[model samples]
Target: MLLSSLYIIGITAEAMTGALSAGRRKMDWFGVMLVASATAIGGGTVRDILLGHYPLGWVKHPEYLVITCIAGILTTGIAKWVIKFKGVFIRLDALGLIVFSIIGTRIALEMGLHPVICVVSALITGVFGGLLRDLMCRQTPLVLHEELYASISALSSILYLSLLNGDVTQTYATVITLTVGYLLRMAAVRFKWRLPNFHLESETSAH
Candidate 1:
């Protein structure tokens, strides 16, 4: 249940960030709610569908849905406040990335899935929500081009799986993972760490 509590925090943080994105485009309240919900829960939904892990999060936990919507509406009133605290949202987003991955990894383990699938589940749960937000907003998906976004998610899977394998208690492991993941992600952002990008400047560059 510790993970569940952290999950709530993660989604609330994510929803605020999503609402800010919606406000950037001058969207209505309805649009804000829609984007907020998507950014908060969309990744988990996609992971559930991929793994056939039925009874999606928002459906089973309607309170979480309500929380996200309320977070969205509140963002509309405090848009300037949200923008001013953008750094805080980035930290929250990093925290959410790990929490979502850990939660996904646990579910996959419960389903008797392979470690590889568990990692995949973590990846899906971490980044698909942002992907959905970008698509809905008609903006380029940041996950695809940003500094170690999905890589951080995928890497957290390794730490989580390793911890579980080491006979660590789930609660302790979750906390440790959260601390390490949050630090790692924030470091990456602060350092501008990124993957090597591929670009083709020529029309006939490759075979």
Candidate 2:
């Protein structure tokens, strides 16, 4: 029940973010809904395809799709408010990442997947939606450039799996992972912590 509620919140938040991206591109309402749905559910769709999990989440629960569309349209009306409170969105995104990661991990575990596959599933579920949103918006994908985004997702999955292995209750494991993952993401943003960049300067210009 708790996970279901958090999953709804995560999709709503993701949808709003996608709406903002659509607005930045000056897209019409239909485009906003398209991007919003993609941003909210694309990750799960991809994960399901890869895992051969029948019946995607949104397909099984069409209300999830409806909720995302409604949230996107609402965001259009409150775009200014959302932009003004950037910190709120940042926090929401962090929460959503953890929530999505936990969901992914849980699904993989239920399917009896290997631990590493579960981690990969979590990473894809937590990050690919944003990747799709960015690609649609013609923006650089944040997961590719941001501080510890995918890493946090992987870490969250690993932590959750570890806790389960250590005989922790699922609820407690989830709460612990969510708290730690959210804080780590926020701290990464606060401290500008990032993986090393690989840049190659043009030799012709140097010459």
Candidate 3:
């Protein structure tokens, strides 16, 4: 079930990014599909390598690629109609992040990894794919920008791991984690919330 959910979220996010980029960059259908597939699978591929999982999740399951391609094609068509609803894309992107974080953490825990590593891995698995996608398209990565972004994913992974350790049902824990992450992200977006920035002072600052 977890894997299925991850696959769905990955495909959707890839398609959405592709479609959005298509609209924004005036890319053709094939270009959009290529970008979408990369956006969807890049992080998972990295995660599998870091986790030392052979065959990789997506490689072992070719259906994920097919789904991503189909999603890209469908989203390309739908994006034209949905372009006016800008907020919808942000919400969907948040949802994808939430789902990916939960799935990544769960997989790490199942592999008997430490909580800290699991949390970090979860964040990487959730955000790096989108970061890679944005970089490839010459856009600023959202995870590095003025929003909670990766912090929310890290928080969700930590919270979910805590709940799991406390004997919570897997389903309940996942749902709660995803909800908390999504809400936190949406709130951050709506309220323009961001982490504090620090500036260093010069030794001779005061004259």
Steric overlap count per candidate: 0, 0, 0
The TM-score of candidate 2 is 0.96
Candidate 2 residue lDDT tens string, 108-146: 999999999999999999999999999999999988888
Best by TM-score: 2
Give the Cα error of residue 196 in candidate 2, in Å.
0.8
TM, every model: 0.95, 0.96, 0.87
Please tell me which model should have the higher TM-score, number 2 or number 3. Answer: 2
Ten-residue stretch with the least lDDT total in model 3? 2-11
- Candidate 1 per-residue lDDT over residues 102-172, each given as its tens digit: 98898899999999999999999999999999998889999989888888888888898999899998888
How well does candidate 1 match the true structure in TM-score terms? 0.95
Candidates ranked by lDDT, best first? 2, 1, 3
Q: How much lDDT does each candidate structure score? A: 0.91, 0.95, 0.79
lDDT at position 156, candidate 3:
90
